[model samples]
Target: MTIERAVPAFAGFMILLSVALTHWVSPYFVWLTVFVGANLFQFAFTKFCPAALVFKVTELKSAGQS
Candidate 1:
């Protein structure tokens, strides 16, 4: 899938995984939720998302091949 689609899916999966960990594993996992949430929030405000950067780099390399 494209990076546009992967970012949201990754975020959602992270959230769900964090929640599951908090309930079944350890409270420390909740920290992951906080971290991921903060990153996403910052990305929204800055319009600078790491996942997008990764996507762009990957696309560039692939395009350079052909």
Candidate 2:
């Protein structure tokens, strides 16, 4: 998958994994999930995701047009 797609996919997977951890492992993990979710939400709203930036950099380095 392209870096553009991978960033959000990884973020989503991490959020889901965090949720699962919170449910099956420890409640503290819920905070971690919340932290990730908040960042994603902020990115969605502000259009300034760090993940997206990283993806863009990787894409540029790889000579991939994003």
Candidate 3:
């Protein structure tokens, strides 16, 4: 998949993983959930997600780029 699609797909997977960890692993995992949510919120405005950077380094073209 392109970077555009991969970024959000990875984020959704991480959010779900954090939620599951919070429920089954430890309550402190809730902090991960909060972090991911906040990161997503800020990314909407900043458009500078670290994951996107990684995707770029890996040479994944965005849909628009293609």
Top candidate on TM-score is 3
TM-score of 2: 0.69
Candidate 3 ranges beyond 4 A from true positions:
none
lDDT of 2 by residue, 1-66 (tens): 676577678888989999899899999998988888898889778877777677777653323753
* Whole-model lDDT, model 1: 0.81
Q: lDDT tens digits, residues 1-66, model 1?
A: 666676778889989999999999999999999988998999888977786687777773333343
lDDT string for model 3 (1-66, tens) is 898899889989998998999899999998988888888899999988989899899999988885
Q: Please provide TM-scores, in order, for all candidate models, with all chains considered together.
A: 0.74, 0.69, 0.89
How many clashing residue pairs appear in each of the predictions shown?
0, 0, 0
Among all candidates shown, the one with the greatest lDDT: 3
Q: TM-score for model 3? A: 0.89
Better of 2 and 3 by TM-score: 3
